[model samples]
Target: MRLAWPLVTGTAAMTGSVSVLLAGMAGTAPLAIGLGVALLGCVALLAQPFLGLATLAVFAHLDAVEKTLFGFLPVSAFKLLSGLTVLAILLNGPRLRRNIHDALREPVIVAGVCLVAIGFVSAIFAEDKAMALSSLQKLLSLLLLPFLVVVLADTPRRVALLICVLVATSVASALILGADFALGVQLFAQSDAATTARTVEGVSRSSGGSDYNPTTAASLMLVGVVVALSHAMETRQRRVLLLMAVAIGTGALILSFARSAALSFSVVALLIGWRHRHARFAVPVAGLVLLMMIAALPLIPAEYWQRLSSFFGGAADHTLGRRMTYNIIGLDLFTRNPLLGLGPGNFVHHFTDPEYRHLPGRTMLGRELHNMYLSVLVQYGLIGGAAYFAMLIAAMRHLGAVIRHPASEAMRVQAVALRFGLFAYLLVSLFLPNEYTKYSWLLPGIAAALHRCNRLAWEGA
Candidate 1:
């Protein structure tokens, strides 16, 4: 690993060692520790190509780190690293870097750009310009997400590094979350959810140790599972690493106890198993896959099965019923403002009004439409929805193409994971309005990067 990415691995090691030393330091030393680590990160940022991909591994922690940094720091350290990477590309401006150009040419990026443009235009008629722009800022920040991955993951080598970083982070997160729950401490420092809120009777039903919401933690853990599955099926080397990822991810996901996330995990597992069972493209990894799934099923707490059953009327509840109400309200909004809808960020503004709550079953309006797709349709209208779906469809199609191509078995296997990871997120998006989540935005980029790397390998580049 060190030989493959000397700069990134070395920088990561330095940070990890410094962090450990700082952890044991008695008092005021820890405050100064943050400054030292931030400086190390800055130095890493100067390494250009490796820096961009490495920053993504750290993205999960970057926001929290930004808040802890001293006021004298000029910018978001993560953003600064990303900006430096882009500047390095501009300076090098060479033929290989033109991979960025080709990456931009992917239909998914085109559709995403169209979607962003449509959202920006919709903001023009927004009820509140300031609020609309604020929402747009977040949306636009995410819209460039795939491009960020594309430029950094331009080569197969970098994509491998990206996967390594992602999987390693997931494993570390699991250890931290699990150990914290066992020790009854908020060991992650940044989660900061009060003792009562984070744990119930000393059992953590979330990644309470980390920055991710429990729901988001479930989704992240699902990502680890999917990637681990792909790697397990595709490669012979480091099978232990893959198994470790699967175990940790599953444990975290179970602790998260998110019904939709659990369902998504099961569906993705089944799909991968089925995909590999067919002889033409099918590999012989089905037995282990089935065993893994079967083992995972019993690990879930009994109450979670009850929670999943609620989705299908095992116990009719207000929250389940409210989703129906949300659908009705969303459709009504779409019908009235069909062309452009209520504009960006208008779902919450429009949905919370007393008048909207006058439905037969619903006495109170929902806080927001908890459905991301419906919310997008309500905000950006039909055109935006079309562009959004088009992007997703195109991305899915590209992955299929990559899988069918004659790349190395390893690339194809990982592509399988990338495809299913995106699918899992799509499944969970149905129940949560996580349209701007890093999970949703980052996936298309990773999938596209996988496809590009596989294609390059096939072409003998």
Candidate 2:
């Protein structure tokens, strides 16, 4: 923990520098100051919860005089912090270095390397070299993720600390949303005009004027719920903390207005019930949830319901129509470049609306397919897609063992609780696009480590 101080200092310094730069900028910078701040805020929002609230207020008052200055704070912060983090790691080589051979044993590291290789090769022959190179960068950049897995692999207590951070983040976000509802105005807002227009009452999106797309938020909250549940099962003394975590996470997921999250949380809840073997509580809880959902239907703003309802009855402009269009275009792109697909992140350029037979503009009648599987298919091609899917499945199998293994009652239940949260979210992500979720990809690493650790424990026994 003492060694971690320098790394934290470097990270904070970078964040502070970027945040100041963003806040100081005047009119007509390439990066919008407000957008910059909000985006970068995502990085530290977990580390410093109050910062988000501060960003929201600052953004609200920003005008042309300071708009660009503050808009791009988040990006600036991310760039600075990421650079500093890398520098710190390099400077502390002895502390940061790992046995590469040993590290590759983790499934996630292996998958990441494979993906990076595929991306690089695809870039060499890519129809658009720049796009290929960019995708390759993103693929390789995630290498840090596996390091996080390996570091935390042997330390369950550290994992518990991370869970605590997540719980705190969720609670803060929920509190922010609650404040927004009470004020009857969007807070911690971005200038996402699109999100603002579509927003209903009671629930506020993370930022103002931004799309309330809850894919990331929902996924994060679900993970929080899982961690909380896991903690609850592990320690009787922390029951209150665990229960508060569950309530905050569950409440935030609901307030998010993300149907996908709702579905995912439902699955997680069921799994939790089953794991606890509180069979008697299952039916009643389900019934209550159903009642809350139904009661919530009328309570949601009409416009909000209109968007949600469109999912069921289908939206002519969006919902079904948009998904079908994106998939059709994606499939065609996949067919053309089946070997590498269109290069990661290249799909948007290749994507077109079949109905209008044209590329979709921001204001046009088109949007991303609210699905992750389809996005992978379009970006990674069949080969990359297969590798990715296989990796996910393999991780799932490894995680499955965590709960299934014959262990002490408490550990078994803890494993069950943990896996339930992870697996349920994976299943729910089918309908929402969270392809870039750090946790989603990181879970495989965690699972691989867990499997290895479990094996070692058994062998020693």
Candidate 3:
């Protein structure tokens, strides 16, 4: 009876507060509603930090949705969620200190910090201070992602859950893209006309309602496919669901008409098959993938085939030729400033210089360097590039250790999955300048977390 009275009184107080908010801000109902939701989310996150982390993962993939829901406000939804999550973590002082200590010990984390430092240092010398500082701010914001994952995903189960959240969000994104294509709608399309109008041989490419362009979307889906494939191999309990995710993700990858994604997916598949050749599930999985490909082949649009074929057309292909031109330009920039290189985010500014005007395809001004490594080298020079490479290498080494550890099969399987996932990112990075991509940092963070979990398990045993 006492509990009932408290609940009634709490409900009355909440109703009164909400009524006041609505009555006071009748013209801004959406804002009021958003505020209410954010408040509730904050409370929930404080109560369960892991849930907040998972929510962040989901929003990371659904960036377009986040912008739609909260773009009006001065603050970003991601930043708000991150702030709340950090506050939640801070509430537990001992755990936060331990997490910070462990995170600092990670070589990948250290290398990442060094890379960021190099970026900031380069920014200080950048000719376009505003642009460089702006880019650096975004980069710094993204840097929090890895630390959050490392701290919150401390146990094997939590790591797995985070992985599942990633996979699930990827699957959801793929499904949304598929629906958009089938319905001939812009359900999740980028707002920019140039991106939406992209075409190959008279066929329009679908970006599908996300902030990501087709290529970026394909790369993100590829990560999901890799992780899902690994999970499929490790457990029978969710085999069907995982396979469905793989199939849907592959479809989305193909639908995006990204040649690099297709190539990377092929390479990762081959690597996984070779690694698990002797396993009992290997042949069946291979056979299923083969069947899926065969079934999907007839349904593929003709333009997609044309796009894929262009990947091998070399100098004859306009896009490939332009990419080659960009590479040369990037090299020229690197040579001109070989030591510290061009200041951060100054590549686009330099692209307009008269000296580069003689280059073929110089008409396409403001185009980013398509290649990630070249972008880093051109922006931060050899030192920063080395630090970036070191971070990736450290992540790969950590995952390799986890894979070889005497841990549970599931953990080992996830490690292998993440390693291949990172490999996919690296392969895609060859074509796309996604050096500062959240997913890139996220894979390493998860790798570090998994490595820590495996080590702790060993020590406990």
Candidate 4:
């Protein structure tokens, strides 16, 4: 009993640690905590039957705290995990930190840290105090995202597992979204109901704008497409099945009616075809294009069609008009506060009025910024934008290294395809805001892990 007691306690502690980490990375606390409890209960019931209750009680307490804190604080669980990781490093001598010496040595990390600092400092002079506070939260949220990526994505196995988890989440989210739309339930909140309704209607006709977010759904579908493509290249028997799944995901992306997603998918597909010269690849690609066109034919409203057509720079595309006007306002804001810009998240608050002088319907009252680059520029200033770009350049350089020296056939194909996928995402990001999404950090983190593993393979050779 005495020996089992220590074991039980240690197991409980470790389970909590694991739960905290998974919850931080995936943003799903209850599920992770449940798994942790199950693990603990299974262990305790076998050795110390009486300890099962105690373990359950501990799990319950943690779950309660998770529910309460995560509801109010988006980063509460993440901060807990960060604290735990730091504590572990302090105790265990920082072994993981030594694994990615190159990533650590890269100057981008320093620049990014400095840019984040400047963002906070600039917030003091922000035009609006409330806007500054919100911006501060956003800045901190985004800054922590990269750190989360670096800390959690330290190994190839972890990277693969992350992808698998995201795939599962995407699939589940799609199903939930479908059900919500069918049931006529509000499954998501959107900044613009009209945009959301149009996008959702394009994807699913019988049901629309359930609880699912179109942008998030679009991003997930993109991930599914990339993963399915990777799987098809590696697995012979499942190749067709994976390709079919990719088609489904692409179809879902179309249903999303996220113009940015459509643009991203098109650009990424072309890049992949050009990179590999796989003419057969065009078969699935062509199928998806046909599917989108077919879907768009009956479902897409005339206004949406007009909006898309007006993308070529015409008076009819009020969407472009809004974006162009936002850019002009963003530029004006940038010029005034060139050093720090309008706080970390205050650009919209400061520039929403007067900037839309021509359009009475145009208002930037919320966090919505159609363009990622302009949004970052207005919020973080040129200094922060430069730092962000530097980090991306470093990441791209690392990916380039992987393509030049792939460890295996699968690795080479995955690396090349992922590079194109990243490019696709960047292209999509041009039309929408995406620097703060979960996928944003996960992709780069996975890329970094792949890069590290390739180096290890080369060293072994």
Candidate 5:
């Protein structure tokens, strides 16, 4: 078997080399180079499938940057990595089947399927079939990501490595945003106009790469902060690195200038502090935080303070009033359909109806509902919304199980961290329609993987 494997790999490499050579001779050097690199990556992923997961983790945060760098190429880096990961998993047929079987049994997985199915059914009944189908296709593609994580991250070591990769990418994203903010440039911005125009008190908001707006970027940093803080508490060896991650993430979150994200992060921080109130380091950490806040007060931009202050109420602040208008429109739409919805992705289509045009709010013809739960309820109606919430509840329950029955201290710590991170995500969702975001599913997938790993460890013990 080993001999056959080597022979196959060697033949494939030789074929790829010849192909690249021919392409290079044809005056397509870039294409040839890309082909060669892709071939090498495929071989590596096949040899060690976990590398595929790590690569995906990196691209997930930097996809916009990848797109900018590889604009000449027709392929998407994120999609390519996903395809490669799937192929790598498929290489081991037995393991793939076993993982699928186990993953299917998870409550989160089941509920996720139900939600997708409901979406599909809603799509069939949508007013704009083309738009609905397109939206559904995207949702289905993203929905597969969590299941893929569950299948690939089977071991505790693999889970830990994946978490580290996520954290590193998050920190890298923060640094990118910080540099952009400092230089007054949008280094890896998804949209120049949006980035430039989005300012508060003359301070522009910074975004993470790859379709992440300020709110989404801030939410991502918030998750990283919680995860890093928890890891710092769990292990002494990597405390410095983890603490640095927390600091950088917090900085990025503030730079985002996203009021809801900031609020959610504050709530999570307080919750964490309260949870560990009796711990030995609690007092010291509280004192350190107080000192840090005092030291940072002067350094913090006036714009940030102004923006946060607007969160309460200000004559110049129209964000809250705008969101309220959107909510009223969204509710009206819900009342119109009340069941399967106007159909998937039809909210914007129906927003400008003659009946709604007379409403008091500004003309937000194509804007989203700005709330995840409201979006789901308006688009998929009660059934799909129920399934979506059920999936999240199931994921939280699974994480809670892991926390209550951890095989190791590390496992317990991770469970707590993930639960808080998930809570932060949910809290942020109240202000943003993030139902289709990758992290929304990835968090739950990691929770499920942790639960399974802990269960397996108990069985072995």
Candidate 6:
């Protein structure tokens, strides 16, 4: 999969750096460690696919880095790793030139750029220009995501590896969450004393931090469920790993007590179950899931249960009421600035404006519309929203085409999972404000990458 010198050189450099750090660099140990990690990561990036995998792994598990000695050192490891990964590809030069061209040509990738351009232009009118620009940066980071995915997961083997990395990371997080569930405490947040814990009813949600708090954690676990389920259906060899992932992921999810996540996970599970109605594994897995559900039934807090049952019983759900109010506010914002809306990230600032004082929302600061679609609609208006929507539609169509006319067995398997993932994320977006996050864009990148594979022979390219 790669040459030997990059590894050898990287190892030697890292070793020599450690030697120096042990001698006279102890005073600047933090800086030394950060530099060493970056160097080593760059070397790993010599193998383009590994760099991408490492980047995604770091992205997925960066929250858990708090367990490390230098976790709280403000190292910006994710940014460093991602930047180095891209740099490494550039260093590959002519070898990767064609791949780079292919990645850029992806419709999803083009659509993402257009979407960002619209947001960038919209930011000029932002009530808080700085905040809108800040949000744009986040969206811009996401735009680079497809290139990374294409370079890393260009082949079937790499795509499988990608899912494996996600599964392993998700399981680790789920285990942490499960431990918290059993001990009734968030041991992971002990380092960040100032980090407020989010709890529903008497249970503490498994929010590692603001980046991956309880809501995000639960939603990610839901994504994990899809990946694991997809791999399980794709192969019979690694049944145990997939089952363990599904089990741990389900446990972690229940603990989060996130209504939207729970509902989304349930819908995906049912859909997958129906899709695999004739498969041999479906029956047993379904039974195990049923058992897990029954066993965990009593563990569900009455408060969460009431929230989940809101639709059936018409219970007065506070969260629902709040989201409704916030959404109405978003509508008003869109109506006023119907062309461009409040700007990319101006919603929170405008939410504080005097004109919206009559709305049901009480607090203005740190306010989110709850619905990502509505958020995009309010901020980017119809044009930007349509561009983003086109991206999603393109991804769905690509995946659908793959399923209908897959180039290979591996392509079919991956397409099935990614198609489900797209729907699952879209469904969860109605509750979770995830439109701007890196996670939202990564799946589409994979879908586009698969589409590219169908056209170009990526398998042994």
4 or 6, greater by lDDT: 6
Candidate 5 lands at a TM-score of: 0.94
Models 1 onward score TM values of 0.80, 0.70, 0.91, 0.72, 0.94, 0.87
Per residue, candidate 3 scores C-alpha lDDT tens digits across 1-461 of 32433444456458756864985568776667666665566556765677778877777777777777778779887888888788677765454677778987788778888878988888887888887887788777777888888888889999988788778877877887788778776676555631565645755666653577778777877887888887677667688988888888888887777888899999988887787899987788788778877888899988788777776672145767777888899999899877676777888888877888887887646778889999989998999889878888888999989877748888887887777778888899899878766787888888888998899899889
What is the Å distance of residue 26 in model 6 from its true position?
Answer: 6.2
The TM-score that candidate 1 achieves is 0.80
Instruction: Per model, state how many residue pairs clash.
Output: 0, 22, 2, 5, 1, 0
Model 2, residue 152: C-alpha shift (Å) = 4.7
412, model 2: CA deviation in Å?
4.1
Q: Put down candidate 5 lDDT per residue, 416-454, tens digits, no spaces.
A: 877888898899999987887788888888888888899
Taking the tens digit of each residue's C-alpha lDDT, what string does model 6 give over 1-461? Answer: 14444655566677767765774446766666667675565555555546555555546543544334335546555665567667667666567777788878778888888889899889988878889989998888778777688766766667666656566767777787777667766665533321344443444466532246577666666776777877677667577778778877777777667778888888987888888889877788778878977998887667666556775755654566667778888888899888777898788887777776776644656587788888998999998998888889988999998888777877787788778867887899888678876667877887887887776654544
Q: Model 1 over residues 1-461: C-alpha lDDT tens digits?
A: 22333554466667766765776574656656665675566445544555765665556422333334432467755556566666545544563356778867977788888888888888898786776787788777676667777766877677777766667666766776677656766554454432234322234554533455666566665776777776775666787779778877777766666677788888887776665575543543556556876978876667666666777877544566776787788888899877776787787676766776676445443356768899889988999889888878877877898889847766776677677777877887887776766667677777777787787777885
- Superposition-based RMSD of candidate 1 using all C-alpha atoms, in angstroms: 6.3
Candidate 3 ranges beyond 4 A from true positions: 1-34, 191-194, 314-317
Relative to the true structure, candidate 6 reaches a TM of 0.87
Angstrom error at residue 190, model 5: 3.1
- Candidate 4 stretches with Cα past 4 Å from truth are 1-97, 100-103, 106-108, 187-213, 230-238, 278-317, 364-367
Clashing pairs in 6: none
lDDT of each: 0.68, 0.56, 0.78, 0.56, 0.79, 0.72
Q: Which prediction has the highest TM-score against the true structure?
A: 5
